[model samples]
Target: MALSVIGAGFGRTGTLSLKFALEQLGLSPCHHMMEVFANPEQAPVWLSAARGETVDWDSLLSGYKASVDWPSCHFWRELAAHYPEAKVILSTRDPQQWYKSISGTIFPAMAGGLPEEGPQRDMLTMVRHIVSDKVFSGATDQAHVLDVLARHEAEVKRSIPAERLLVFDVAESWEPLCRFLGVPVPDTPFPRTNSSEEFQARLS
Candidate 1:
């Protein structure tokens, strides 16, 4: 299935919640970094893309109805171009809070020194290459990271047409997202998940 939504948000920006929210809105099978861990074979494809290799976007994301978080987020431009009809969602949060979330969760996990010879390691390496090296330029300073975040948000806002892009914050909940996607809000509450504590626990 073609992607109906392309998430240009970095990981830890409530992306996990957004994944569940989109799925509930009928955009099921949303891809996230967790998907790469679950489907090991997909790692090399993303790794290749991270290394600037050509990839078949359609085949790479064949079963996903939407995509979010890292790996996919890193390739938003390509995905948006490939799936012209797909709407882009730039998920964001307070830059300071976002840095805290990542520094405590993903950054530590990436630096946790997990075994170097497994699917998880491969996935982490790919994320490091795309997010750390490419996006943040191997710098972890608060100022630098926040600058990258701001710059990315600005770039997305400038690049995508107003009608085709939604700058979303998961905290805003259902209404805007529902309206943007032309879907009714669900009867249940929006998903709130994968907090820093939860992410830390998973790594342990």
Candidate 2:
């Protein structure tokens, strides 16, 4: 099935929670970085995409109803073009808070070295190329990273049509998201997950 939602948010921006929320709202099988780790066979396809090679987005993302976080976020423009009917969610937060979350979680994960071979290393390499090299220019300084974050949010706002785009913060709860997607808000509370400490534990 085609993507119903395209999340143009970086990691640590409540993407994991979004993934879960989407599933709760019947957008099951949402794609995220965790999907890559779960399906090692998908690594090469993404690595090729990271290298600027042509990719069959349909073939790569088949079966997923929504996509978020890295890898997908890196290709959000293309996805938005491809799935014109899909709603784009630009999940965001205060720049400093966003930087702090990633610094304590995703940044360290990217900086942590891996073995020279294997799917995990390959996936990390692809992430580095897209996130570190392309997005951050291999810089980890807080100010620089926050600047990049601001620029990305601004770019998303400028690029996507206002009607189809929703600038969201997970803290806003489910009303806006459900309204944007024309779906009813679930009776349950919003999924709160993947905190900095939890992320570190997962890596460890």
Candidate 3:
């Protein structure tokens, strides 16, 4: 399908659950960060694209009908321009809650897991700078967290077309999401996976 959907939301913002939900809504085979992990060999190709090096968009997104999370969110503005018919879903949550989640799960993974001196490293750093604090180095307080959330909200609103953009709160579950995708609601609540505690336990 030519109809691309970009989930330009940070981690701990329901990106994974949305991936499954979108697939259920017929946009199968979505690209996500976890997929990148599963196929670490493909890191170079994606890293090149993230670095603003030219790439065949269609070829890069070979089987993906949609994409969610980190690197995807980073390139959303460009993706929207490339695919005019695409939909952009900015997943969100309470700023404080999001801050807690990131401090507890995401930042630790990024800082310790990803390398700091290669294409993948540069790409990840770029996304982190755009989405979170580049200077603070894992600081998540009331002011900084709110700042991140607000900036994310503002930038997405200003950059994307109204008709194509949907600000989604995962707490609301499947109704709004299904409606946005023009699909019937499934007989299921959104699946929650990868909790903050779970992430910590896995990494530890």
Specify the highest-lDDT model's number.
1
lDDT of 3 by residue, 1-204 (tens): 554798888777878888888887788888787776665555666566655688676776778899988666777777888888889999998877887888878666666455757656754655455445433335656587667668867999998888888899888888998888787999977867777877788768
lDDT, candidate 2, 1-204, per-residue tens: 999999999888999999999999999999999999998788788878878899999999999999999989999999999999999999988788888888888778888677789988888888888888988999999889888888899999999999999999999999999999999988899999999999899989
lDDT of the structure predicted as candidate 3: 0.75
* Candidate 1 runs further than 4 Å off: 112-114
Q: List the residue pairs that clash in candidate 3.
A: none
Could you arrange the candidates by lDDT from highest to lowest? Answer: 1, 2, 3
lDDT of 1 by residue, 1-204 (tens): 899999999998999999999999989999999998899889889989988899999899998999999989999999999999999999999888999999988777767565659887778788888888899998988999999999999999999999999999999999999999998888899999999988988877
Clash pairs, model 1 backbone? none
lDDT (CA) for every model shown? 0.92, 0.91, 0.75
Candidate 1 whole-model C-alpha lDDT, 0 to 1:
0.92
TM-score of 2: 0.97
**True-vs-predicted CA distance for residue 132, candidate 1, Å:** 1.1
Which stretch of 10 consecutive residues in model 2 shows the poorest summed lDDT? Answer: 106-115
List residue ranges in candidate 3 displaced over 4 A: 1-3, 113-142
